[model samples]
Target: MTPEPQAASTRADPAILSIADAIAHPVKAANFPQTILRFRNDRHAATIGLDALDDKRWCHHFGRFNPMPGNLPQPLALAYHGHQFRNYNPQIGDGRGFLFAQFRDDKGRLLDLGTKGSGQTPFSRDGDGRLTLKGAVREILATEMLETLGVHTSKTFSVIETGESLWRGDEPSPTRSAVLVRLSHSHIRFGTFQRIAFEDDAAKMHRVVRYALETLYDQQNGENDAAALLNLAVERMADLAASYMVAGFVHGVLNTDNMNITGESFDYGPWRFAPTWDPGFTAAYFDHGGLYAFARQPEAIHWNLGQLAVALRLISDAPPLIAALERFGPLYQQALVRRFCWRLGVVPQGMETDRALVGAAEALMMQGGLGIDAFFFAWMGDATPECPADQQGTEGEALWSAFGAVKAGYAPARVRTHAYWQGDAPQSMLIGEVEDIWAAIAERDDWGPLSAKVDAVRTMGEALRG
Candidate 1:
């Protein structure tokens, strides 16, 4: 076996503690009956200097929720209120999770280690705090796939199967339970500000805004004011929405609480990849209104940003925040052109040509009912030689016309030489495939398939990054 990284450290820098105390509450972890190390993301762990931990130590810290040296003295469940499905709910917060620790990577970027399904807290009004093992597995798969697609997503760092059975209406009775740990830039959500605003605490709002500007947006040099933070969030969120579109992902839940101030995607629940170019595809069964549908994601993000703007009014006037909100449409349009071109493996021609090309491609996809993955996979770099027989037809001609206009002056951005490019089919994580992978683990405890899938995803990431 390869040796672990030698520079791994045991101490952590709990930066969230620097903020006000009203937003955090001390909580104790559930006493799990057993701790079986199921999955560990050593690649990401190495970045935070935690890869050297053995399974025993990993469980002690992640499973048992022990504090690392210099980390938070105890686990703290965060407080935040949000609009769940457009209904203002001030009673919600860290119901099943807490901020466990924080660390700085080798590049000096602050990263947070947070838990999910660790246990119940003051916010657990009428629910158990356990997580289904299957849920944990799905989150692992989702993060891996999103990361490979070049989306700014949280990393699923560790999962440990707790010796407990969870009962839920959605799944079969007494499903296996697990605890998950995710690595993200910040756990402070859009609702975090809303919570303080609801309390009419202007001082806390300013303090938290300054804290976010310093810890999360530190790279955004100069003018660390509320308006500047809102502008930065607008750009990041617009790009995030575009990345999800190009990746064919539906986050299922777009509540303000699920959206962090950093604009990174996390808290995956009932997320799905579109099987084809269906605009109204919905991921969650409970989304009866399809408010967060596949095609409406941009709208949902914009609406969430407006809520953030409303919260930020506690510190800044409406003019600047409204101005920041107005930029979303233009930013999203530009982001779509840029990200769509990147996925197509072509350098973007100017804005007008790129926009036309994207429009044509979308029209072709909808007209032909083409699979999202297949369309991008076949047309990457516009090589066409490897294009599937079914994807080439009269409808594609118009798309090709627009594509040619965009490609007239630019060469392909990536070569189709990677081994993954030679495969007969592209890597996809449709619900069927995800179920098959989970079925293996549920029936026979066979982890080979999951391991292989992660390896394939990382390899695909390498090819894309090249």
Candidate 2:
């Protein structure tokens, strides 16, 4: 039975109190004519005790940009510098988005409600500060899919379509605009530290590191200082990189600013999931060099970690920071095997055996051009003793033989109950399918397909989580 939704409450917490002034600058939201509430994430809202907000009140706070009671009085456009495609960009910051407010979830963890396409700020260069409806829809799909696949990611808390048409170079001209609110662990990024380091501000860097340790890494003993923080960041980031690889996801732009300090995946732009197991699949079209390709994600994140280590030099010695950075490779490799084994519905024998299993699985995927999601979905929980008659060829023999060696002793019955596994294909969000889903919304204002897709994806998530 569905539970009754709770009423909206703006209870305050000691979240983001210290860094508000030091890290972010005040800004205003862009006023639009209409505030059509399109989506609200009730599950995530329940976690933060915000599921009780009625449509009008929800629109007032999210759509109209009126401050939530007991939250931040004014929106804050965070300050930071980032490397865009490996080139340092000193001027970039939160151009279209801002840190709207901070609160605590029921689990006692701090979370940030940040806005995308709220309004123009000092960071807004020559371009207008707006987000297209299509972009919002895509982010919704991306977050939902990643979450279902067991990746730590930000939730798309709310999406309100602002009644305005805007022009863009990528999509059709005069695209509909909307404002999205993302609920994340923290909006502080690697670039936030980079900005302070670039200024050569040791004291400010120390303060930022301390604040981060207190807010995000509360598990720490609060004694080790900057080096401790770097170690924690590296460990979390290694887990994050492994999650992406196992989920077959490609984050198109791995900029320093996009890499969250809490190691959660957010700010999805031009992201993609591989249809087949191709190591060279690139998500963003502008990525001509394939620097952030599917196979190179671990490398990309390791590079970003090095940049974080360099930034930590503002407050700590070089040797300890380097030592922390060196842990990424081993941590990532271990996490990759664990995550892969989980997806394959098997228990890992050990590092050596797990490594061999992973290598064999990848070989099968590449050799047969197997659909990444389909392969997992089909063999989920465990493979049957007999191979399918259609797959009795040499390729099938090699694939099943490699797979049989790592099959779990016991399979969970819950995974086998899912109807998705009964089909020949799995739920996928390839680019062509995403475009088709958007077409229905744009042409006829039909939301049936999109709604159904969300339901299917959520069901998949439930199966995976089980």
Index of the highest-lDDT prediction:
1
lDDT of 1 at 227: 90
lDDT of candidate 2? Answer: 0.85
lDDT of each: 0.88, 0.85
Q: How does each model score on TM-score? A: 0.95, 0.95
Clashes of 1: 0
Q: Which digits, one per residue and each the tens of the lDDT, describe model 2 over residues 1-466?
A: 2332444443545366577767788899999989999889988887778888788878888888787667788899999998888898889889999988787778778888999999899999986989999999999989999898889999999999999999999879899999999999999899999999999988888888888888887854455577888888899899999999889999999999899999999999899999878989999999999999999998998899888888888888899988999999999999999898888777677788888878877876777546788778766775554555766786866787676665544344345666666666788888898888899999998878888989999987777766
lDDT of 1 by residue, 244-314 (tens): 99999999999999998999999998999998877899999999999999999999999999999998888
User: Which residue window of length 10 is worst by lDDT in model 1?
Assistant: 2-11
| C-alpha positional error of residue 78 in candidate 2 after TM-score superposition, expressed in Å | 0.3
